[model samples]
Target: MDDDHDDFVGCDTWDEMTAWLGESLPDIPAGVTIDFGPKDLHIGDEPLDDEFDDTDPIEALCAQIVVLKHGRYLVRRSHVVMEATNYLDHDASSATPNLWFDDDPTGDCTAGSIYVDDAGLAAEICVTWLRAESGLPDPTEFGFDISEATHLPGLPGTDAGWSLDDFLRRLGH
Candidate 1:
């Protein structure tokens, strides 16, 4: 994992976070669909009226990512879709606490969220969520785990994993 902790935290955009996830995780099975958008942005095949425009100056931003697992298995096969989320609490003052991932998108499972500005941590939270929805109870299956109440620190972007620089390069930054 990269020892330069500062460099691996807090991603500023969805593109960057998506790039990091693509580079970090193992090859997903074909036909897997990963839908990422603002929280409460979509419902039942229709987009909500208050969709995020990205230009609107907001106090807080919540990004929801849902992965539809077809017929895969960690311990057993699951037919239901799973969702995870990350939030950037720009409105968080010394007194106001940040928002978290608690909504049950599928109306069945309510996964946790990571309240950090780090992109790596956000990606890690998604990974953890996927695992939890994978029917596997073991957290060590992935290498590390984050506390449910204290959502801090995340999966280490190993030496073999792609870095933010890689995403920047793709963007010609």
Candidate 2:
């Protein structure tokens, strides 16, 4: 296995991608969560799958994922795109302190999902997405220093880590 990336073998279908990612990325920390959606079946503009029946045409995609990263929400669609969004609102950087988490890929208010490596990164995204989505701790406390591998405040894994609900309650969310 190469240190740069896990021994991940590419597969054609989203199901294969799902198997590989879930099996390969075992070290994802406790609180982090990564969701994998169904594969898209489309013939040009028409969707061939039932999952997309009610979903918007543009938002429907293959291998969609939503995760938290560094106190913000990051969404990955079609395995090649990672977009940092607030999720609750698709504001698209229309205002100051936009919902994005980083300034690199997300600098222009976006990111590429290919930048995501494995579970370690996934967990960070999980916490980030949760913190923002929960609307807790107040936006005034936005700068809470949660680095990679650092558990959420009060979570069992860290000295100051806390559970998601507890963190929210502490701030009266």
Each model's total of backbone clashes: 5, 16
Find the 10 residues in a row with the least total lDDT in model 2: 138-147
Candidate 2 residue lDDT tens string, 1-173? 11112111243333443344344344223323333222232233344465655333333222223333333323343322222233343222343322333444333223323234344454344334433343444222211111123434876854434333342243233
lDDT of 1: 0.32
Tens-place lDDT per residue, model 1, 1-173, is 11221122333443444455545333322122233222222323333246745343322112233221231211111223233223233222232122453543433233333234333454555544534454444322222111111224785532434343453344344
Q: Which 10 consecutive residues of model 1 have the lowest summed lDDT?
A: 141-150
* Shift in Å, residue 165, candidate 2: 25
lDDT of 2 at 47: 49
Q: What lDDT score belongs to each candidate, Candidate 1 first?
A: 0.32, 0.32
Q: Model 2 reaches what TM-score against the true structure?
A: 0.22
